[model samples]
Target: MPLYKTLTPNSQTTVKIWKITETYDDLLEPISLKPENMKRVLGMKSELHQRGFLSVRHLLLEFGYTDDDLFYDEYGKPHLKDGKHISITHSFTFSGVVVSDGIVGIDIEKQREKIGVIAHKFMDYEYQYLDQSDDKYINKLIVIWCIKESLYKLFATPGLSFLQNTLVIPFTLEEASTHAWIDYQDKKYRFDTTFFEFEGFTCAYALPS
Candidate 1:
């Protein structure tokens, strides 16, 4: 029953986020799933993942979509039959869906100190301005990770390197928005990414800049 927050970044895009506060059964009971999706969710070993999967269906319902309207390409990027662009992301306690008239991506992640431990793997250019001593360092890192993840979802191409091919422009938490680029396969792309934090989690969405 928790529909959570909804967003309209522009006239053509909508973002919905669900805060999971229901038992697996409660989430499962309300929505009808495609047979394959039912089998897929039931087979998930982690209850967290099971709930995450179900919550996305609820988000889809908010957008007036059902599993039948969704499909995955060979690259595993999700698509809507009506030709609108879409991307989805789920974390430990939240799930997000972004539907747009143009290309878009969305992600939600729990903000934690551990992100700094793995920052090296996905971050490169931003390191020049990233200082560990800053109080907002963790928050900034989470935003960068989410931004890169959103771009990855939008690009949907294999061999896209977060470290080598993607870069997040410098910004403070107060700004809440930045620009990023994807340099892959000898082509370059740009996106405008925005992020916000809630209940200890960070969620970001990307749209073509």
Candidate 2:
């Protein structure tokens, strides 16, 4: 089990990251999935996605839960049966989950220069502080993208716009954390966001504050 990292953001929240190095059969050997999830995983066309899905089940075990303890809403946000909040994300070789007493979201993304091509799609207020000429431009954009994605998962609203509604407050890479807001339907919600990099991938998470 390559349980790569664990973070206790607070007393009530736990974030666990896994490095996906096991074969599909290896991941399946220790755990049994619920019927629906088994069917869902089997239908996935990509082996990477299958492994990511199975890897999450292992993370659930680390949290003292199981596939039967999780479910998805109409909007496709995952939830715990006991009422605790949970958010999950996986990209390439990394997968992560955040479990908290309050609403929370997590995202992991590989650092890629190609993000610069679509930066305009999701960034506006952040551009004021971002320096494209700097070496950290791609890192900063990945953080922003993860922040917005986490916020979207946290909010779980039907039509929230990453560009128009989500706002990531400025912060340097050294800060490791910042704040963000979501302005939707005349109301605003604030979150305290944190991010970190490991093995060329960045993981960002948000907790409602």
Candidate 3:
């Protein structure tokens, strides 16, 4: 199954989402896995993660690239062989990839009640403006979680607490997009955020300035 969604935030950036339903083998049948990657593949916990890898591989191919077209840095940040910025994400049943010449980050999370329990740990400024009018609080929390996680990925810095370092400017739950910032040291990184509901999941992608 190929679940597809495209986001065009500006003339300079575009994002594509692919939801994969096939088992790991089914998705990897078309691609060649390296010995190192194959070794890592043997450690995957579920078919979900397996397919996630395959789906991202397919994504690279779609972008006119191949497996060898990507490389990971010491921090595990992915960079295109041609020097484009890229980010990858995967959840229980869905996986996503976003690539751009600019800084980019992508995240997918299953909408769940449990995320609410840890909201305070990552939600500081966000708590001030979260609309409480809706009874679906979990949905609201999931949206915030996705946004913060996307920020975390974008920052790629260790020891930055979500609640302490990241802040979301308030918005209605029904809104299609939100804005957020990361204050790390003296530099403030701002992001234009967008979230959408799909297959019991909330997916968020952020581009940095």
TM-score of each prediction: 0.97, 0.98, 0.92
For residues 1-209, what per-residue lDDT tens digits would candidate 3 score against the true structure? Answer: 76477777777666777878677767888887777877777788876667788788887776777888888887788888887888888887677788787888888889887887888888877777665576777887888788888888877888877888888777666786888899888888889998889889888888875
Error of 1 at 193 (Å): 0.7
Q: Give a tens-digit lDDT track for model 2, residues 43-125.
A: 99999999999999999999999999999999999999999999999998889999999999999999999999999999899
* Clash tally, candidates in order: 0, 0, 0
**What's the residue-level lDDT of 209 in candidate 2?**
86
Model 3 residue pairs with clashes: none
Model 2, residue 52: displacement in angstroms?
0.3
Cα deviation at 26, candidate 1, in Å, is 1.0
lDDT of each: 0.93, 0.95, 0.80
Worst 10 residues of 1 by lDDT: 1-10
Candidate 1, TM-score vs. the true structure?
Answer: 0.97
Error of 1 at 198 (Å): 0.5
Can you tell me which runs of candidate 3 are displaced by over 4 Å? 131-133
**Candidate 3 TM-score to native:** 0.92
